[model samples]
Target: MGCTTSRYATGKKKPVPIREIVVFVPSTRVPKEIDLRRPLRGSLSEGLLERLAALRAKVVALSEKWSLNCSTPTGNIATED
Candidate 1:
């Protein structure tokens, strides 16, 4: 992604010819999901729903492991903020 040549130039002198370089990154249209239930229905889109479900499954698995590792008064844990 580059070009080079001899006889370079510097400031206060003739400017060196410039070559352009470009980098590319691949991206997908995958969207993020946020869970919402009754009493507070979420504006979840179809694509987002799938992503949310996958994320929820992960959290459940992690919570199970964490609960076993550290027992506390609250059987499960939650965050208010």
Candidate 2:
């Protein structure tokens, strides 16, 4: 018998039919990483590059603040009067 055939005659449990499952996952396109050590090469406008740098600085500041808050001992702080 062919491999696809069920093995009912061998007194064994019949093999389950193979099924194809297609899952469609929606995802956002992420930009490729740019090496900050080197200068950017493109026709990108200077204004846009400045804006990006400002945003990066803001992100770094927020990250530092988050780390400081997390490192503090929350249990030792009195929450109520």
- The TM-score obtained by model 1 is 0.34
Summarize candidate 1's per-residue lDDT along 1-81 as a digit string, tens digits.
Answer: 545554446544565544443434333222344444432346656677667677877777766666555443344444344
Weakest ten-residue segment in model 1 by summed lDDT:
21-30
Clashing pairs in 2: none
The CA lDDT of each predicted structure is: 0.53, 0.54
Report the number of the highest-lDDT candidate.
2
Q: Which portions of model 2 show Cα errors greater than 4 Å?
A: 1-38, 75-81
* TM-score of each candidate structure, all chains considered together: 0.34, 0.43
Q: Per-residue alpha-carbon lDDT of model 2 for 30-53, expressed as tens digits? A: 334454423753755677777787
